[model samples]
Target: MIVKRPVSKSLARAFFCIVLLSLLSTGVALLTLASSLRDAEAVNIAGSLRMQSYRLGYDLQANDPQLALHRQQYGRTLDSPVFQQLHHRWVPMQVQESYALLHDRWRQMDACLARGDIIWYRQNIASYVAQIDSFVLALQHYAERKMLLVVAICLLGFGAILLLVFFTLRRINQQVVAPLSALVEASRRIEQGRFDHPPLETRLTNELGLLGRTFTRMSGELEKLYRSLEESVAEKTLSLQEANRMLEVLFHCSQALNVGTIDRRCFRHILQLVREHEPVSSVEMAVGATWRLQEGEALADAPWQTLPITMQETRFGELRWQGETADKPSPQLMQSVANMLGRGLYFNQAQKHTQQLLLMEERATIARELHDSLAQVLSYLRIQLTLLRRAVPEENRAAQGIIGDFTRALNDAYQQLRELLTTFRLTLQQADFPAALEEMIEPLRAQTAATIQLDCRLSLLALDAQQQVHLLQIIREAVLNAIKHADAQEISVSCVSAPEGHHAVYIHDDGCGIESVNEPEGHYGLTIMRERAERLGGALTISRQRNGGTLVSVSFTTLSGEQTAGRPDNNNDDND
Candidate 1:
């Protein structure tokens, strides 16, 4: 197989032609193997036998009514003559023993079933099924292994032929060809500008070795440049990885905004993510007017670099990252992190402001509706009641009492209607908790002669829109109840941090203390307050104030996002 001929044009051509023909023959064998593999899908005898055995067992276990049906299904497979002929026809010598035993077992089981020998039938049938299952599994395993081994042998044989041809060419180059030939080959490889060559010492050590040494020296210099190139590639790869990490951080921040998660430490979390990748001593992100995210040691004492962050022509903030090197972490890197935080914060603020405007607009609309429809009707009823009161007899006690009752009921209805209009008339002007609280309690002062005072120290808790809405509602309900039910001189609202970081809101009034807080017909307001409190994921407590008034408070912890009471499912009735 070592076909290393000297420099002869005709002989070299002849040798190459012969080798090409041999490779083509090998390719033909591989194609034949592929065809055989495709045909192997039709080899389903063992699998068929396995299914038949299961069918026979199922027939034996059938109920009285189903016995005939199961028997018919079973007869189509193993019980029929076709399966028997198939089982005996191939008769391979290697599996002759297993085939003969299976054939005999099938006949015996058939005979037992026919004669109604229950005990022997059960015993022999179980044995027959087990043997067939084992044999089928064995056949399947053999087939898989045989196919894999055949493919592996063919591939390995082809590889060996290629390896043989390669060595034959190497032998021809080294032994038959001299140093001049080596020089010629080396020059050609050099012309291609590929420096990956075998050792020069292994080749002829004459002028060829000197030429190889020269080429090796040139490649070694080129190797220094290659090493420098590899280092540059590694640096670029690291930058790419850092960039991807920053992208993921930005993606997570975007999610926080989408979920309406109002986090005061939003920028801090983002900076911490940056510090994870960059070699920075500290990071400070000055975002907007009041929110500044500072992490690591305060960089006040040390001189730090700054990168201004801007979005949509509005310069919102700047990022300052202090590190060991002056130019290691680029300004672009610092600004990228800052821009994400700034833009995200800006987006969140814009969304919140837009929502507030929409809410106010909708509230105004609803207030107009209540005034136009229900308020008009209440006014007409009140005027009629006044006329009726004037016409009543001045001295008749029973008539006067009835008239008074009617007047009081009409007044209560009008008051409730007016209160509904007032509730939908106003809106939350600001997103802050304290500002919202102050705005909510403003109307209760005008509605009642009672002095309303708000005492809030709720800085620790950050609540989203839904929680704020629910809290405001609960406070409103409490205040209304105090004014209507509890005739109080002074009403004080307290919002302070509770134990375990929970926030408690308390509204107290020096008014009539209820002996009963049950859900009576007239006490619908208390029920509404309780429901709003539940929406805040907290309990509403109504107890006697220390000075003979009412104290209503709601206590809740931090939340993930805005949450509300789910509407009852009308579609569930259809399912039922």
Candidate 2:
């Protein structure tokens, strides 16, 4: 089955014939098409002759001053290079004869026009136009004939190539492929230490046939030789296969564990890989009481071997395996895998903790920056507005009202800046979302006499740190709005999951409802809330409840990239 020659001479000759035939036909067809490119030009020129003949006839009757120019144009049209090609010998006899007749008639018509014989010119114009029409038709027919010739040449060439390919393939299949396939089959059986396979094709007179006969004779000798060492070969082969399997398992386990961080999913993946590659009927990994991943049959009473997934004194998880096979994975290999898992988990926690610290540091820096710059400016503005209000006359009620509005707006801006600074500082306090939410609400609760309740059912939702931050900010915004605007006694902040895996945070207050959800000119509370919701791939809604009070809800699915729908009352009333 080992072919030394790159290709057979016969195949080379066949390919050469195919390529040569293809090139010849393509060249001829291209030449024909190129020549026909001018056929359209000839037809267009001949067609123009009819229109010129009619114009000239009209000029003779009208005695137009442009008659001389029209006559010269007509002559040029008839003698154009495209029409001159009609005189070539290769042009059909019908086309050539038509052009000649049209030319002679045009000359006579020119004589009549030159002599000012209006009557004779009028009579001959019809016959002259008829000849031009005949010439145009003839040119069209010639172009079509060339197109048909090109098509015929292409079809013949394609058919010749197809037949050549079919013949070559059939010969290769019969003479080369068949004999080689039989020889390969015989060699395969001999490699497997099997000799009672089908016989090889040795009747043909070729190198392949010689190989087939040689294979048949060699297989007989090998059968005798293989019979002597078959048992020992099987034993060695099995042992090698087992060793290779174990090595492969260890290699893949290392690769799977090589990540910047590991999660529960990664732990489950490692367990699954162990079950697939090792000769184990079942595998389980337990990392504390929360994350337990198992693969294969679960037999509680079976004798399970345990490997501690530990690094030094710290233990991250446990790996257990159970199987009835005598070829169980070695204890050393299992322990190595367990150690890798432990290191992966340790690194995962360390990386997360480090990232959280970095995030907190960044938040604290931003808070300090805002407090020094924007917060100081807002405080100055509030003091200036108070001074302006004091300077306003108490007698001018209109001036007093305007100053009052300015004072309220300035105070609102200052409050919002302080709240923002608080938000940034609060996030640095706790990395856990629930703890952060509690801290964020504690200060707000102190500002109002309202009873604030926190119901967080976030056990089913897995939120990353960024998502947690955005969600907490949105809740804080809604809760602040309730406390400042909604004059209520009870405010409920609930974070719950829906049956469809959607998580929502609802801040409801039993107070007077908001007239409009739109923030006033200098306010951006609702706008900031919406932006934060969008960052979480969610939507924010601020609507009035049926009885009274405002309900602000933000809903989003666990799966990212989806925009949650929000239905808020489209009240356009201005906030006074």
Candidate 3:
């Protein structure tokens, strides 16, 4: 069982009281001693006077015969002279009378002794001596009484001082030492983590009680703070753990998406992964102008049109999704899905076009056979007709006219076949991106009379062939839209490396600001630009410049040197 201690304030107050009481007691003792000393001095002075009076009477008796006789004669008349003066001034009235009689008797004896009267001298001398002895006895008694009184007072003062000291010590122990000891114990308990115990309660309504109350309040506050701090730390630790788990999940998802080839299957897998980790309702793929999901069969509540999908100039499809609930997806999750879809589309387009190329190659071979054999035979027939026209020439005007018309018809047939062959050869091929961009802008410059400048700062060798192609396509569409729709006087196309370690293409057109158009049309040009950028794992942004112009920008990561070979196919006919 441990006991709490009292506060320091109580001890300090008790000590102050002790010191005050001690000073008061000491002052009182000194005053009592001084008064006693004064009384003793007065008593001593009285005793000395009585002794002096006795000595004077004796001297007068033993003096010369003549003077002694004169003293005897006047003794009866002492009231009239020196004896009267001495009696009146030096002693009390009662003692003065007694001394006067003694003096008279002494004078009578002295006068007899001087006249040879020894008998008278003896009798008077004995009587006077007795009276003087009695007087001296009275004085001695008075002095002894005064001395006894002073001694009694001194003893009383000593006893009082001792009692005060004892009481003071007891008070100090009760108010200060005892309480302080208890306070020390309480502090020890507090140090040992026993905050449940309260401090000792001092009942004195002074500083001691105040200190006790203050200590109690402080202890309570400390306990509350400790508990609150512990709870806060626990909550923060749990929050950190949850955040770490979320980060781990995000890391796993990133790794899975970054590896492997991108395709429709991969795209679906990514959606599934997102749904498993997060919360997604449905996903849809749109290729060209066609929605992969048929009408009334979308996974989400709204129709496919409600999704953010653009149809016209879209090079490849988009995968638009929403959360199962009304909540929007996290921006981080959305960006991740966008990147995965871009890479997936790139691979899908390459595979689709590779298959298309095979079919086109077969068709081209058949067309070449037809042109080489059947067309050659037809050519020979036309040549034979030409020769026949020359042979019948001289005077057969109708025959000559017939041969010329036949030759003209055969030449027209040959021209048509050549045109068909040329169209087939040019069907799937594309020109170099920069050259293609230059070509598209030439016509824009001619039509708008705009000064269009192209700044191609990007190193073509640094970009993968596929990225280069998409970048150029995005730029061409952006420039065309700005020049035609924006109605600009000047257009600037710039391609450079983005500060964020990506390639960027920017198109600025001096035109009416974007705010001027209350509602911009969903032109295929913008859609195509977005699709091309997305397909290359890039982003496209459009904004009205502070000045009167429209600005279009695209940014995409550049592939490393080793990964640049075998460019991804862009044979996506899905222009929607």
TM values, all candidates: 0.45, 0.43, 0.33
Question: Candidate 3: which stretches are off by over 4 Å?
Answer: 1-202, 262-576
User: Scored by CA lDDT, what does every candidate get?
Assistant: 0.64, 0.76, 0.57
Which of 1 and 3 is the better model by lDDT?
1
Which is the winner by TM-score between candidate 1 and candidate 2? 1
lDDT of candidate 2 over 465-512, digit per residue (tens): 556667877887788778887889999999876543467899999999
Runs off by more than 4 Å, candidate 2: 1-257, 261-272, 278-353, 389-404, 428-461, 483-502, 508-516, 543-551, 558-576
Q: What TM-score does prediction 1 earn?
A: 0.45
Clashing residue pairs in candidate 2, if any? none
Span of ten consecutive residues with least summed lDDT in model 2: 567-576
Candidate 3: 10-residue stretch with minimal lDDT: 288-297
Give per-residue CA lDDT, model 3, range 459-517, as digits (tens): 32224334555665566656666765777888899876643236678889898856642
After aligning candidate 3 to the native by TM-score, how far in Å is the CA of 31 from where it should be?
Answer: 7.5
CA RMSD of each candidate after superposition: 43.6, 43.3, 18.9
